[model samples]
Target chain A: MDKQYSEDSRQFVPETMSNMRFAVLVLGHGEMGRSMEHLLSGRHALTFWERNLEDGSENIPLEQAAAQKDFVIFALPALPHAELAERIQAHISDHCICLSIAKGMDEQGRTPAAVLGGVLGPAGRFGMIYGPMIAEEVRAGHPGFAELGTTQSDVYERTRELFAGAPLYLRHNTDVIGVSWAVILKNVYVPLLGAAEEAGLGDNARGFLATAALEEMARIIESRGGRRETAYSLAGLGDLVTTATSTGSHHRQVGRDLVHCAPGDTCGTGMNVHSEGIHSLNMVQRFGLLDLESFPLLRLVRDIVNEPRDVAAKFRPFLDASFADAASRNTRD
Target chain B: MDKQYSEDSRQFVPETMSNMRFAVLVLGHGEMGRSMEHLLSGRHALTFWERNLEDGSENIPLEQAAAQKDFVIFALPALPHAELAERIQAHISDHCICLSIAKGMDEQGRTPAAVLGGVLGPAGRFGMIYGPMIAEEVRAGHPGFAELGTTQSDVYERTRELFAGAPLYLRHNTDVIGVSWAVILKNVYVPLLGAAEEAGLGDNARGFLATAALEEMARIIESRGGRRETAYSLAGLGDLVTTATSTGSHHRQVGRDLVHCAPGDTCGTGMNVHSEGIHSLNMVQRFGLLDLESFPLLRLVRDIVNEPRDVAAKFRPFLDASFADAASRNTRD
Candidate 1:
C-alpha cells in the first residue's frame, strides 16, 4: 500500500490500518452519502456514485465501481433502491455486502430489505442499517447509534471493522425483518408529534402520543412476523424520538403544515415534497398491510392526513378511546 | 344538593351531578397541590391542608379535613408521604380512596405505594397516579395522561369519575407496585439526557440514551416485582420523554450543571436543591436495591452524579459496551 496525503497539508504519511480496510462504494451524493464519506474516507478506500451525475466530476461507470467494491452502501432514497440493486447485482463481487440506510417502502410497499434481498437472490449478503443516525450530526463528529440487521455473521464483523473508529455504533440483530419494519414504521409516527405540537396539546399529550405509537408499532411489527422487542430498540423508539423531536425533521414539519391548512387541503407547505413518512403512511394503507381498526393511533394519523380539518379535536377522542381500550385489555389480563 | 355559582359569577345555578360528587381533601399547598385544585375545584367539594403552613388563610385541622372526605390526594413530595399517610389513616373514611402522585421513594427506599399500603392495611383502597402530569401544564388546562394503579375496581371507577370532565386522563392498571417503581425509576434517567445535551452529543446520542435508559428501567422494574410492560407505558417511557426532553426539566439541568462543574464539586447550580432524580439514585444505591453490574446506564448516572469530572467522555464507552453486550447476548440466543 502507498502512503497517503492529508487533504489540508498534502504531506505524505505512512499507510496505517489497525484492521483490514475494505473498498466501500457509497451510492448517492446526498447528505447521507457525504456523511458516510466523512466516517469512512480515512479508514477505507472510498468511491462515490451519483445516480443523476449531478456533479459530473469523479464519474465512474456504475458497473466498474460495483465490480471492484467489497461493500455497496445504498445511501439513496428507497425509490431508487430496487432498480439500482438490480443494475449492480450481476457485476458486484460474490462476497460484497449490501447495506441500506433507507427508511421507507417503495411504491409497491416493499421495504428496502425486501428489494435488496429479492435482487441479491437470498445469499444473505444484504442487510439494513437503521436507527437515530441523523446525517448532519454524523458529519459534525458526534456519535450515532444504529441496529445492523443481517443473517450473516461475516457481514456483521466486516461492518464492525469497516467503521471501527467512527462515532457511529452498531448493535447486531438477526431479525432483518424486524429492524426493517421498525425503522420504516417509526417515520409514520413522526407527523403525529408535529400535529400534537401544532395543536397545543402540551408535553403530556406528546408523551401519551409517543407511548401509544410505540404500542401500535410493537403490535404491527409482531403481526408482520417481526419481534415485538425490536419496536422498542434503536430502530423503532430511538429513531422515532430523534425524528419526532428534532427541529429539522421534515415529517414533523408535515404534521405542523397539516394542522394549519383548511379542510381537504391536500398540499400544505410540507406536503409539496413528499416525505418518507407520508410515503410509508400511504404504502401501509394502500397495501392493507395493517388492520387499521386494531391500531387507533395509526388510524388517527391516517384520518388527520386525509381530512386534516379539526385535527386538534381528533386527538382527545382518540386518547379517550385508547385509555378505555387499554383499561379493558388490562381487565381481561 | 345545593345550587352552585361559577367562581367568576355571583349568579346561582341549579345543582348538577351528572355523576356522584365526592368531598375531597388535597394534602399540600405546593405547585402540584394548586394544579390538582385547578382540575378538581369546580367538580367536587374540595379542601386543602398545607404541611408547612405557607399560607395562613383557610386553615383547617388535619383530622377534621380527613374525617369527612371521600378522597385524599397526596400532592406533596415523597419524603412527607409516610408520616402524613399514618396521620390521616385513622380519620379518613373506611371507603375513601387515597391516591398519591408522588414519584420518589421514601428515605428507607420504600415506594409511596408500599408506605401507603403498610399504613392503610389491606382493604386495597390505596392507589397511585403517575405519568406526564407536569404541574404547570395541568394548571394551564392542557390534558395529562396517567396510569391509575389499584387492585380495587371501585377505586379505579371513582378515580375515573373524579377527573372525567377535567383534562387529566387515566388508564387503569392493577399493578400499584409496577406503576410506583416505574414512575420513580424514570427520574434516574433524566439527568443523563441533560448531560448528553451539555456534551454536544447531538440528537442521535439523545435517542440512544433514552432507549438504553428505558431498557435498563424495564429490567429494574421487573427485577423488583413490577411488570416490565409498565416501564414502557406512560409512567415509565412517557414520563421519561417528557422530563428528559422538556426545556424546563430540573433533572436535565442537573446533568448540564454536572458537565460544567469540576470533579468533587458537590453542588452545581442544578444540584443546589437535590432533585428527585438524585434522591432516587442515592436511595437505590444506598439500599442495594439493584445490582449495578446488570444496569450500565443506571450505574453510569450514579457515577456521574458522584464524580462530576470528565462527564462528557463517559458516554461513548458506555454506549459501545452496551451495544457490544447486546450483540453478544443476541448471539447466545
Candidate 2:
C-alpha cells in the first residue's frame, strides 16, 4: 500500500475485509429481511439463508451460504431468534458481530434479547437497529432511519458505521437491551392499536390506548430488568407510537382481525396474529405479577388474545364505557 | 363539611390545605380538555369553557371562568394557551392552581408547564396532566389517565388526590415540566409516522420513526426540565403511543391529511388535515433548532405539506427511494 493509502487504510475499516466475509442470513426475508440484504450487501461478501426465499429454498442450510462469512445477521421473527442464535453460535467466530432486528417478546414473555443473550453467551457483539424505518422504505433507498444499539458502545458505533454507508438513515445509541425490549414489547401493542383504529374509535381513543400501552410496557420491562427510560426513548415510546399510527401495523391488523368477526367473537374472530402479548398478558394476569398502575393495557391485550372468541363484545363495552366516567387513570397510590 | 369526609380527605392530603374548596375550571372541551373536565367533574366545582361553542349559553364570562377555579386548566392548542394565561391573570384568585393538559411546544417551543409556571408567578400551583388517555375514552368511562406535577409537591398531591376517584387514575410526580414537554412534542411526530405508513412503509420504518420521535421529544422535554423516564411513563410514553396508534389520533391523521385529497377520501390519492409535524418539520428545517436525531417523520410531513399539488409523482418516490439510494440524504459525518 502507498504511504498515504496505508495511512487512510489504517484509519478506515475497509469495506471488503480480507479473509473475513459477511454472511447476511436473513431468516424471515418477509419485508425487512430482503431490504436488510440490500443494505448489508455491499458492506462485505454477502450470502443469505432466507426462510422464504424468492424461489422455494426456505430450508436451505446456512452452511451453503453462511459457510465463509464472518458476520451473520438474524433478521427474522422472534420465533426463530433464539434457535437461530443457537445454530449460529455453533459456527460463528467469537470476533463476528451478530445482529438481530426482530421485535417480539419470546415464549417466556421475555424480550428477544433475553433469550438471544441466553443462547449467544455474554461475549459476542450483538447489535440491533430499530425504530420507524420500514422495510419497504429501506429497500427503496429512501432515507428511512433506525437507531443502532448494543452493549458494546464501540461495537454499536462500528455496526452503525458499517450500515451507515447504505441508503437508509441510521441513528446510533448504546442500548441494545433497550432496543431489543422496544422492538419486542412494541409488537404486543401495535396490534392492539391497529385493532382500535379498525374498531372505529377516534384519535382520542387511539392516543389513549397507545399512551397507556407505553406506560404498561415500560413498567413491565422495568420489572423484568430493563431500564425504564430506555423503553421511553426511541426503542419504546417512539417505536410504539410509530407502529400504532402506521397505516397497516400488525397490531392494527390484529385489531382488524378481531373486528371482522361477530360481536360475540372473543378473540377478534381468531384472525389475530399469534403475538407474545397473547401469552404475556395471560401470564401477567394469572400471576397477578403487577400492580394496578402497571400493565392495564397488557391485561386488556391478554384478555383479547387468549379468550376463545367473544372478545369483541367484551371489548365493545370498553368503547362504550360512558363518556362521563372516562376520567384520567393516572395510577398513583 | 362533614367531619368524617374532611378527615377522610385529610388522609390523602396535607393538613395545611385540606379545607380549601378547590374550584377547578377546565378550559376547552376537546378530548384532552374534556378529559380533564371528566376527571375534575364530580370531584370539584368544575366549570368548562369550549372555545367554539356556537350554541351553548350556560357559559360564564372569561372573567368568571378564570375567577378562583382553584385549578385553572388550559386544555387548548399551544398558540392559545399563553393567551389564555394572560387573560386569566386578572380573574385569577389569590392562590389559584393553574394546570394544563395541552401537549404542544409554545411559540418558543416551551413546554406548557414552564410557560404556565413562568406566567402564573413562581409560586403558582402550575402542574399538568400529562399521559395517554384518549379524550373519548376518558369521557367514555374508559381509563384515560395522566401524571400531575408541581414545584410544590404538596400542591401536586392536592391535585392528584382530588381526582383519585374510581376509573380516574392519576400518577404523581414532581416532573411537571418534563411531562408537559413530552406530551406536546410527541404530537409533532405522530402524524409523520402516519404518512410513512400511507407511503407504504412497514413495521421497521414505523417503529424507527416512533422511537426517534420519543427520543427527540424526551430530549426537548428534558432540555426544558422534564424527565425522559416520565416521557416513557403513562403520561409521556403511554399517551404518545395511544395517540400515534389511535385510529382517531391527530398525529395519525397527519397521514390521512397527506394521503387523502379530501378528509373523507380514502382512495389514497391525497391527504387532508394539517399535521403538527408538517408545521414542526418546517420549523426544524427552517430554524435548525433541533438535533440531527429530531423528528425525520416530521420533516417528511413538512415536505409533503409544502409540496405543490402538481408534484404528486415526486411524493410517490418515497416507495422507490430505498431501491434507488434516494433515502440517503444526510451527509456522512
Angstrom error of the Cα, residue B297, model 1: value is 1.3
TM-score of 1: 0.92
DockQ of 2: 0.21
Stretches off by above 4 angstroms in model 2 are: A1-65, A75-97, A102-149, A152-176, A194-202, A219-226, A233-235, A255-273, A276-300, A308-333, B1-126, B130-144, B152-170, B187-204, B233-235, B238-333
The segments of candidate 1 whose C-alpha lies over 4 angstroms from its true place after superposition are A1-18, A53-58, A268-272, A331-333, B1-18, B53-58, B268-272, B331-333
Docking class of 2: incorrect
Give per-residue CA lDDT, model 1, range B148-188, as digits (tens). Answer: 88988778877887875676778888877888888887887
Interface RMSD to the true structure, each candidate: 7.0, 10.5
Error of 1 at A275 (Å): 0.8
The candidate scoring highest on lDDT is: 1
Candidate 2 local lDDT, B1-333, one digit each (tens): 345423322222211123344677777777666666655555578777765558655456777777857777787766577777887887787767777766655566555666776777776667777776666655555555566666565666566556655344455666776766566566666666666556544445555555556655666767655676665656655666566556666667765456544444442223322444444444444566566444343444455555523223333343233222311332222
